[model samples]
Target: MTRCRLCGSTALESVVDLGATPPCESFLAAERLDAPEPTYPLHLRVCTDCWLAQIPPLITPEETFSEYAYFSSYSSSWVEHARVFVEDAAARLGLGEDSFVVEVASNDGYLLRHVVDRGVRCLGVEPSVNVGAAAREAGVPTLTAFLSPETGAAVRAEHGPADLVVANNVYAHIPDVIGFTKGLRALVADDGWVSVEVQHLLTLIEENQYDTIYHEHFQYYTVASAIRALASGGLTLVDVELLPTHGGSLRLWARPEEAAGEPGRRVADVLAREKAAGLQELSGYTEFSARVAKVRRDLLRFLVDAAEEGRTVVGYGAPGKGNTLLNHCGIRPDLLPYTVDRNPYKHGRYTPGTRIPVLPPERIAADRPDYVLVLPWNLRAELVEQLAYVHEWGGRLVFPIPELSIVEVER
Candidate 1:
């Protein structure tokens, strides 16, 4: 009876199920640890109709994002990524102080601050008050509300239609994918361009990235599903770029359906690549569940072996995706001991489900653990570079995703 969230197709087949798990971002304070915690079925389904892979909307946006603990400014590489994006986008779009820019889900103004610094008029629509307040403090104008058709209309009325609309990493987080795209269509001027960044489904399947399947990420889009969803909302995909961030992601450029422009060759080329890779068929999804199960077994074995050998192991980056991997593999503080993050808001709070203590990065060198299990495998390069000092003690790094590999960092 369950239908696909995007295309409303009842021909939904289970691809990968992570069993019952808590919301990935539900980091718990000491007082809440003693109280009952809730967990939901973290199962993914693929639609035969449109090839859109998604999870049921079991949780609301307010419950998942209203008062968030994640801040994008904490990651040095991610902040630099934002800066580069703004610089490139500004140059490409011919943006200036006279042009208006708006970014949805602009956490902590990590991206918009760069837009403002370039002297472009920018505004951020962020629902999380904690991050929104931080954005305001950083001199970025922000609204503490989720973006929908209604809010998009209000923004258009107040500031006129934006020349550039940015929604990076928010496409997967939104429950109503069609509505969100429609809102983008409404808010963007006919000549304006909309940019959306999402982790490509092909990489998630091909690389055994099941950790990205938590409740907050309701949709995992392929090129086909993304095109269909965007077209449904009167928007058209014009260009596409493959990025290495977040394992692998797609940066799609869109325009109003009525706008006059030719779709870039990258669009057809990407679609052809996806189709050849078997994204349009069920076989591409069938082998995923087995691959995901293998990852869990291998990770558990590695952790158990490390514990039996009496070697110290700790985690780096308490990201939401990390919580999913930790909880799905049934790892607790005993196996992980403690994890470190740069976000001060998450410090002193324990990770959801696994209950691993979140400490400051300074603790990593103080303890000098034998191994640092990197939870955020997508940011492995940045983290590996940041923790290169661990090599001073003959310590190594561990990545749980794609496969379990213990790597040594050379100083």
Candidate 2:
């Protein structure tokens, strides 16, 4: 039995089983094709004690993102989101040139660059070699090493404490989940803020976003689970926000007890809403799994039928979520001929495990495929506008998950 990583509770039950899938970032080299791919079980289980949902131990952070391939600057939406976050964070916290800021797992300095733009004293601690290097190139001072209790001590030893510590979408990646948050508490100043963004478990289940169930994303979080973990580490939740990025996400802010900062009514309200939505209960999980399975079944049927009708199909956005959706749905060259990515680094490479080729966006514009699959369904509206020319050819875009639907040309 795989015990819960956060709470160490052995009384756990399977919530969703996505069978086996290749690591979302395992985009293989051409020569490596035909070699057996490592397929690991992608099952999410919730601990009876803490109600934390997590995948069983399979992939390590050392293997997942030690040398990362995905760069945060590559996504326009993400970069814009970072800019908005920087502004809002500064406004809310009264941050300015005098305040010191730090970010953990700060990929490519997306948010830190914005901090620097505001003339604040900021540094980024990024463990990934490629991502950290890019941040340095952009004049964002960064330390390249995995964050641990020791690393946190080292950071405190060098720079003392920070006024603001930002950790975006990284709250779920660490398996030593409790240890990681404890490290955060040690690094932030007594009255400083630590803000963390994680995809919300409530949104994932409600939206049937099973594609978010990759090995790298070990734990799915709710406000209740987050509070339980943070309070154990001596930090208190101060505020929370629900974001639309990454299908759905929650931004949580924390500080020490000596600061005497209590969680806001919004945080409690959301937690109460979570319980009211049945997330604290068991039936919500089982029913969510069933709904996610139906999405898979329906997606496969639609793809197979589209093939029979001889309709051309391609994909948009070579995102990690897209890889999860494609790999879980067992889609390959037969159904999706190729996927167009804005990131040139990913354009020529094959998607992990599925081996569907990634090409530039110009390919879609030139080929005018009959049907384009918007894999990053959350950004479907943005993609539709960018590729509106397809409508000129009477082409439509297909969204697989949530439901199998199509968008036709307005004119």
CA deviation > 4 Å runs, candidate 1 = none
Query: The CA-based lDDT of model 1 is what?
Result: 0.91
lDDT (C-alpha, whole model) for all candidates: 0.91, 0.86
- For model 1, state the Cα shift of residue 371 in Å: 0.5
TM-score of each: 0.98, 0.97
Q: How well is each residue in 1-411 modelled by candidate 1, as lDDT tens digits? A: 288878788999889889899999999998888889999999999999999998989899999889998999988888999999999998999999899999999999999999989888989999998999999999999999988889999999999999999999999998888888888887899888999999999999999999999999999988889989888788889999999999999999998987837888998998898888888999888999999889999988988998999999999989999988988889998899999998888999999988889999999999999999998999988888898999999999999889989999988
Q: What is the lDDT of residue 217 in candidate 2?
A: 91
Model 1 / residue 30 / CA error / Å = 0.7
For candidate 2, give the lDDT.
0.86
Which candidate comes out best when scored by TM-score? Answer: 1
Model 1: what TM-score? 0.98
